[model samples]
Target: VGKIPWWKEAVFYQVYPASFKDTNNDGWGDIPGLIAKIDYLHDLGVDCVWLSPMFESPQKDMGYDISDYQAVYSRYGTLSDVDNLIAACHARGMKLILDLVVNHTSDQHPWFQESRSSKTNPKRDWYMWKPARYDADGNRMPPTNWRSYFAGPTWTWDELTQEYYLHLYDTSQPDLNWENEECRKAIYNEAMRFWLDRGVDGFRIDTVNKYSKRTDFPDAPVTMPGETDQPAAEMWCNGPRIHEFIREMNEQVLAPYNAVSVGELSNTPLPSQVLPYVSAAAKELDMVFEFSTIRLGTGGPFHGKYLYREFPLSELKAYVATWQQWLEGTDGWHTVFCENHDNGRAVSRFGDDSTVELWEASAKTIALWQATLTGTIFLYQGQEIGMVNMPKEWPIEQEYKDVESLNFYGEAKASGDAERIRKTEKGLKILARDHSRIPMQWDASPNAGFTSAGVMPWMRVHDGFKDLNVEKQEGDDESVLRFYKKILKMRKEYSGLFVHGAFRPVLQEDETLFVYVKDDQGSEESGVQVNKRRKALVAMNFSGQPASLQEHDLDVAATLGCKHGEELLLVTTLKKNDFSRMEAGVLKPWESRVYLNF
Candidate 1:
């Protein structure tokens, strides 16, 4: 705590470079625009910021499909822009975390270009390529039954070499052949050396689990209906050799610099398998973004109707609790989040955004929960103001660049059926690209205050911009922005209580009221003991109806710096810390407060 482990107790804000700010009025956000907002981030009290990919790319996958590993994209600005931003962040006492998309690259990349040039090309083995198998009709078949996460077959036949190359994601994003030591080392050298040499603080690795595949190239079982192709990744995600490869990368690149590495592992990863990948032994990542809580659903199109549904509150609580409990005493750490650049806004999914007061209330509740957790806290761009997901009825055109979402829509169309398409739309409403990639709402002006050049933005901003924006919130101390700033400041002020305090569930029968406690060692029984009162309690009433306590909940003390006193600490609604008793003079509707009683 001497030098200040900012990552351990600070908020990490994520910026989707293209949508954050526009400098040249080209309608696309650039680095210079982001530099203009460094003061805004510092004012928000964030200690670290994790930026999404901005490397040279074909834009087929929106920068995830890297065309050049080391260079900056021309549209995002030059290396000078990056250096200037880094210097600015350091000067403000904030750290920067870069997104490292090493799992794959654009098929147009130089390595792939060389590998595709000829079978004897020096980089020929840089990617996974397999000879096609002859079908019954003598037509060529893809190497495996692997379906790309996108919508079609994972293997694309390469006529140049009479072989099939694996693309676990988009066909344009060919998977790197990690089995080849040279390929692994080359990727490590390119990604690690470029950033570390440039003085980056750490990385958030993209799709790290996809690197390991089963050696035999076995087909994956189809979970989605009507899916036949099972690409090589089915046999490999989180494979046996993943740890070995991660360890090598860490030893060769990450360990030397003491950088924070957060792996993006989709598909609820098991803690036992995840621990080694994020062990503190300087061998792998510093933490990982596990998608367990987000992926919970009842059923999908393939399954009968109503099979997939939004996750129940109990399920989400249990999902997060499992991983949090496992990493408690271990050196391993976890990255916790409700939304990101890839997922939708957490407000609509988790908060009751039907009304302004309700939305603001629920938003603060979620923020409190995330900020008080053990792992690093991640706040999506618009989340600070409690932005909700886009309405499903709102027509979204075909210009969307998110591959995962577009693929689902295309798959529905291929079936010549409206039922699947309807379900797909519904699925997206619950969980899809529309949630996370919306344009940042900066003001109540045109384009939700995102742009003033009168140009069309890459994506539509929220319609409620007239009331919800940075400029409006900046002046109002009772806004969600103020609440977030206060939360961050509280965490930094009492870093020890939040960073290392033990988490205990404050079990409640009501699903809407998700409650818990964070206590220091020694005082377990008396909820109000000083030695054990390290930020004592945390609670949120997700239930729409007013909720309160039946009796005195252990003599509530300081309400975690939240606005609940005669004088307001923070407030999104007009009322400041105003509460009324229920039938029996207990807590009531939408009432949520956290206290450190002693």
Candidate 2:
């Protein structure tokens, strides 16, 4: 806790480039657009900017499929624009991190092109290439029964080589062979260093856990009915040499430049499995974004996220407690977030987004929840303004431009399962990556001020922008935007508590409320002690109805020095936690309050 790293002390903002802004009226956001907003982000107290992938790509997977790691996607801008952005952020004292998709490359990339041209090409071994297997009738099939993350068989057949290439994601994005020493050296010595040398502060590594795939390539056992390909996350995630590969990456590029790296890990659902990656002693990643938190409302296997599941408040409490308590005494770190480019908005998903009045309170409450957590918090663009999901009535072609969303609808319609297709539509309404991809609502202007009205955006802007854009909240102090600013400053002011405190979840079994203690009055050798009274308590009501937090056996009054009463630091609702309510032990509906444990 002493002399913490800058990343641990700072807040991060994730800018989904395509939807951020459009200066050239190209119907797309470019580096210049982001450059225009550097001051806005810096003013929000953002210390790091985690930009989603903008590498040269075919845009099949929305830029995740990189054709050239060193080159910028022409639609975004040239390398010079990127250099300008780095300089702009640096001028404002902010760090910028690019999304590194080394797990796969676009099929059009020169390396993949040469590898697929003929089996004997020198780079053929750079990617995973396996011979096709035949079934009882001698019909050519993929190497295994595994499915790609974007749907369909994991292996795609190439006519040029008459062989199947492995792709854990889209068919156009081929998985790199990390086990190949030459390939590893090439990525480390070329693609990665290119950015670091160009002055980017660091990288947000994509699908980091999939790098070291198991060589056996066993057919995954069918886990769900009416499924075409078996789910293979168990075989492809956390492979034997994942640590070695990551460690090599860290030693090669990360440590040399002292760059920050936050890995996007897949299928690593436990804190234990993730510890090896971010634990300082391990010398791997600085932190990681685990998928378990986002998987809360997702349906079971096969239908995957297309079918909705009821999200229980207690389960969310469990996820928070598990990750927080698990990493308490360790040096490992994980990023805390509710919304991202690949997930739904936090206010709509976890907060009360049914009405604008309720949305602000609940959105601030969710922010309160994360602000109190031990790890660093990342704010997705437009989240600060309490942006909700796209209305369900928006047509797919108009608003849902994500490849995953399009694929689900296409597959559902082709299956002829009327009920299944109906459910897919309904599920997508509740949650889809497209919900997060909606254009940023900067103002009430045409196209939400993201792009000019004369131009057609690749995806439609959410109609709710008329009421929920950043410009609307910028001047309103009670707005979600303002609340975020207040909480961020408080987080910095009390860094000893929020940043370096020992996390203690109180009322763990209470489904209606989430209350946790962050005690800074402790030592490394001995855990948390209530000496000198430097503890802070965060309490939230996770429902529409009002609730009271009964002091439990966890003993908030005793852990904190009781005589000092309470110092209300932050609250979601307008009315402060009055003494009458404190005495009555009631927290307003969707109310969140952080108090110094006096």
Candidate 3:
């Protein structure tokens, strides 16, 4: 067995640039603001920072629509600011991974500008373009029935060239034509090389699975209700040539620079479907982000992402266990995260946010579970302080700025159905991306210390910052921030076990308790027996009610390789009084515990 890669043992922290911090009183987070927080991230125990896109853009989709891949958006700062940020992070012994949105570019990009100028333009082949399909009455129809991820038609008509372009997201983001060899080379040289050569560590590739498309441009099959006229992702997601393209990219760009790449794989229905993208032998991506676990509690496939519903504890366990089992012996790896820029705060979704005690316990429980898992842990901004969902009472018109949320609101209102509009409002409260876009809560200042008092933040700050801000939580021993640091440190202390241990789910059928153990029984490498063995058990209660398990339920005597009395209580969510109850085989609501055998 070879040594594991640094990324596999590292912890990742994701920063939504606009929401992280604001300096110069610009009311938006910039490169300088992030530089000021390098020490803060270092203190949080994260090994790498995954920054969202900061490239030049029209801000149509909050910087996902890039107009110039090589330049930093003015809202973020000048290119010099980015250079300083990279140096600052490296000085603190931390890596920085920039978000790479290569699947598409803003319509305002120079390539798209010339491509749309005329049918015979030299850059016309740089983007995905197709002749319009005309109806009986000569009205224009799209080339396919594919629907954008946001909503509506995937193809936008252009009168100049009498053609339509494919955009899987907001229309302003035009899909790039990977089929053109020149386009691919040019993109690699200009977009990827520019950053890699500048000393940035790696990239978190955005919408990587959408890079390839079926050359024939066939219509997609409708798979869901109310999706008859929408674009089916099955036709293009992880398309036929995706693996080939990624492998080529690795050979050309990533491997030479020793940079890591994690692809954002959307619509990947199974673990096997993602293996080739991340498998070490495939030489494609270093890892891939699959959302099966994240979508577990979001009503599955039929209910849509925005519809809110409670997921069963059993289902959550099954989802996590399945992925753990599938990738156990494979070279493929996983990216463990409870929340990101695209979803609501995990504390609000997976944990109870109704009260302070429940919120803190639930937050710590989920954080501990993720940290102990056999994968790279990803922590989103403000997650350490236990951020919750945006208040439901705020009017959408005033608070919501995400393009997807605004589009959904417009469609719901136009339907003139009050009940449907009400449902949309509820869905936005629970699942809107804006829920995670609120400014970082630094303190109890007028703007929560995210910016100057008079300069308004781009998005409304969550009102609960008075108690949940970083300043208040930094010194408190029981704060969620402290718990996160403790667990992160544990990962570092037990890297061999946590990073390379074999995972086995215990108490598999338990409805309320999610328990799993990591075992490193040692292995033979290079024809020599290496004696490095360890065992650790992680147990978490998923419900908001007390639960109990008998000694037989844990089988500690047999699995620990020692007497039951020899087990060490490494960490737990319980306090002094709760520990008394725990000793009697009772676990408080949302409690988590990790035990080690030495």
Best by lDDT: 3
RMSD (Å) per prediction: 4.3, 2.5, 2.1
Model 1, span 1-598: residue lDDT tens = 1343446666788998888888787777889988998899988877788889889998888899999988888889998999998998999989888998877889989999999888899888889888888888998788887766676787898888888888878999998989899998888789777787887898989988878888687766665555565323447678878888888888888878888778888753578777777667647787788877655662532222222476667777787678666777676767768888776677777777788778877777777777777667888888898877776666544534577777776676677878867776677666676567777888877887566748788777667777878888889877888888887777655555555566666553446666666655412221213333355566556667755543425223433422344222221222355633123223344555555643
Clashes of each: 26, 0, 2
Query: lDDT for every model?
Result: 0.72, 0.83, 0.84
Residue 423 in candidate 3, Cα distance off native in Å: 2.2
After superposition, candidate 2 runs with Cα above 4 Å error: 522-532, 550-559, 564-572, 575-584
Model 1 lDDT, residue 468, Cα: 78
Worst 10 residues of 2 by lDDT: 522-531
Worst 10 residues of 1 by lDDT: 566-575
Error of 2 at 560 (Å): 3.1
User: Model 1 segments beyond 4 Å from truth?
Assistant: 1-5, 222-226, 230-234, 297-308, 522-535, 551-574, 577-588
| lDDT string, candidate 2, 1-598, tens digits | 2455788878999999998988899899988999998988888889999889888999999999989888889888999999999999898888999998899999999999999989899999999999998989999988888977777888999998899999988899999999899999999867788889989989889999989888998888888656769888887899989999999999988999999999988688887898999888999999899877777788853446688888778888888788777776677877788889887888888887887768878988987887877778888998888889888788776668888888888888888989979888988887888988878999989999999887888778887888988888888877888888888888887766776667888777887888888877433323323246477878788888777555444344554555534544444454443444554356777887777754
Can you give the lDDT of residue 85 in candidate 2? 93
